[model samples]
Structure formats: C-alpha cells, structure tokens
Target: MSIRIPPASWAFRGFVLCFVFLSSFPGTILTQEVTLDSIRIFTTHDWFSIKPTVYFQCKGENKTVFPDVKNTNVSYSFKGEESWQPLTKLEGTKCKRCGIYEQDPLTHDTFDEWELCPSDFTAEGTYTHGREKEFNATFLCHGCSQVGPGSNKESGTEKEEERRGMRPAIVVLIVVLVLGVAAAGLVVGYKYWRKKKRQQEQARFLKLFEDGDEMEDELELQNTL
Candidate 1:
C-alpha cells in the first residue's frame, strides 16, 4: 500500500504574468490559469516521473512546469469535489535537483542540471527573478484534482480562480445561446397547445348543446300525445 494525497476538488492554478516590454514581444499579466485536466493513477519506472506536478504556469506564451512546486501554493481535496486543503508552502528551497528549471547565463536556454539537473531550469539556490522550467517528460499527478468546466466561480481581482468558475467567454456565450433557443422552443410549443385545447373545448360544448335540443323535442311530443 502507498500513502498518497486522496483526490481533491477541482483546482484553478493562477499567478502573476508581467512582461518587460521586450521591444517586439507583448503580453498581459492577468493571473495565469491552469487546470488539472485529468490525472491518471498508475506506476512508472522513474522517480521524478512518479513525483507530483506542483505548479503549472504560463510564461511568455508558453506553459512551463515546476516540479519543486512546494506543498504550499498547492491545495488538496480530501472529500468530494469543491473541498480543498492547501499544501505546505516553501519560500526558497534548493532547486538544483532533477527537473528544476534554470536559465543559462551564456546560452539563455532552459535546461536541467550539469549532469543530472539540466541547464534549462531556474536554479532554486540561484536566479533572482525565479526561472520557470518545463519538465518535458510526462508524470503521474499524485493527489490529482479533477477539473470542472469552471463557469460559476465568483471572485474579485487578484482573487483565486476557481475550477469551472469562470468559463472562457466564447464557451459561455455558446452555452447561453443554446439554452435560450431551448427555452423559446418550449414557449412556442406551449402556446400552440393552448390554442388546440380551446378548439377542442368549443367542439365539445356544441355537441352537448345539440343533444340537449333533440331530447327536448321528444319530451314535448310525448306530452302532447
């Protein structure tokens, strides 16, 4: 048996995104968003491949991975969906190990270690601006959180992003349109049904009136005879 963090509610990972006006490149910093689309529970032969993916950030039109993602900035769900427990946060820990991202002062390319830790990752012990590293190999998301469509969250600026809380604008518009069309169809059907019902009632009242007149004539003739 293995000790693991049980499934957590849907989580929306976010962070600040600021660009230095790199002459030609432009970008906005409105809290980077990340969703745990899906997490498969299985075993792999490697160690880091089996470790948890702590933080998934968007940097300069790119999605990067940080395995040293301390337990802090991460939240967990012990019960069903929507419940969360935050992991322990780490301020500055040694990030010179495997999968730690850093920038080479000479090449400026993100690599792990010298022999083990590549040169691409931002060294935890080094790098003042915090270099974001991308782990190329895929790994198992231990204590993985399920992702929701996330269109119902209410949050303020700098507020944490909720899973499935705020949906993409285009997606939200499409959903609203579909629901509107369905509602209109129901209303039209109801109106037509009401009209048909009124016609049926009129026909029934006429039939009853005609039968009553025939009965009255028979009674009058019997009395005269």
Candidate 2:
C-alpha cells in the first residue's frame, strides 16, 4: 500500500528523464539560433540554355548570418526582377561531420576513433552550414550558353573535325600505297624482259643447226673418191 510521488512530482519526473536523455544525443540539443528557412531555385533548360541553382534552407541552427536578427541574409531576383541579388559567400564551401567507429571485440582495437567530434563547417558559394541542405549557389544565366561536347569551344571544334576527317583517309591510303608499288614494279619488269628474250632466241637456233651439219661432212668425203 504505497503511493507518494510528490516533490513537485519528483521534480517533474526528473526533468522528463533528463529531457529524454539529452534529446537522444546529436550535438546535445542546442538548436534555435539560425533562420533562413526556405529559398529554392533550381531551373535547368536547353535550346537556348539556362541553368540556375540556389538552394538555402535553415531553421534553428546551421547559422551563417542572422543571429541578433536583422536580415537580408541571401537574396536573388529574375522573374521580372526588381533588384535583390545579394548572395556571395561561396568560398571553398564546407560541411563535414562524419566519425563513428567501433571495432574492439577483445582488442580488435578501434574504439570511437575520435569520439563525439563534429565541427568543421564552411559551405561557400553563398555560405551554408549544417541542417541537411545543399545546392548553395550557381547563378550565371544571361541569355544562357553552354552547348554540349563538353565545350572547350565544343572540344576544339571536335578536334578540328577529327583532323578534317583523317585527311581524306590519309590521302586515300597514300594513293593506294603508291599505286600498289607501281603495279608491283610493272609486273616485275615485264617478267624480266620475257625471260631475257627467250635466252636470245635459243642461241640463234643452235647456230643454224651447226651450219647444216658442216656441209654434209664435206660431201661424204668427196663421194669416197
């Protein structure tokens, strides 16, 4: 039979369990100092290009201006502009808070590696800082221009039209390899001058058949006397 809970309700239940365990730890709840809560502009177009991108959102911490309250913070115009362009703090942009290591099952050693450390902010391009927001600034669209082929003057005019389309296929493959080595040296100099004129016409027909068999052996030895 016990029922007594009251010392201002046990100090309001121990300040609501230490504000819900320090608001579930993440920089231990100190949010309520930054403002600029909305400003998105992300247009993109082609066919007379235009590509604007300016996102800046914030609400209670991630501050970059507007602390004592009195603001203009970041501005923009162009949709029938009336003058308000004032967003220029993008210098080396920054925002990195990553560190959560844990490996030590019996000295596999690697604990916290750098415990509870998160602070390195400088999002430049019209200053930005914390609060899961991106696209800081990138406006340069005046009658837009940036046609494709990764412009460098369209990649040097597509490498001078691929070297003027490979100089007429390298001058038609060096004029068909110099007319195929001048038609294989005129068919090997006309088959070596027709095999040296058929070996000088078979040595002049065997010297006219050995001068007609030496005049028939001197008329059969003068008819055997």
Query: TM-score: which candidate is best?
Result: 1
lDDT of each: 0.32, 0.34
Expressed as tens digits, the lDDT of each residue in 72-170 for candidate 1 is: 223222221211211111111111122223322232223332211112123221111222332232222221112122312222332233223334643
* Candidate with the greatest lDDT versus the true structure: 2
- Our model 1 lands, by Cα RMSD against the true structure, at 20.2
List runs of model 2 lying over 4 Å from the truth: 1-156, 176-180, 194-200, 218-225
Candidate 1, residue 25: the lDDT equals 25
Q: Candidate 2 has what TM-score?
A: 0.25
Error of 1 at 62 (Å): 23
Task: State model 2's lDDT.
Answer: 0.34
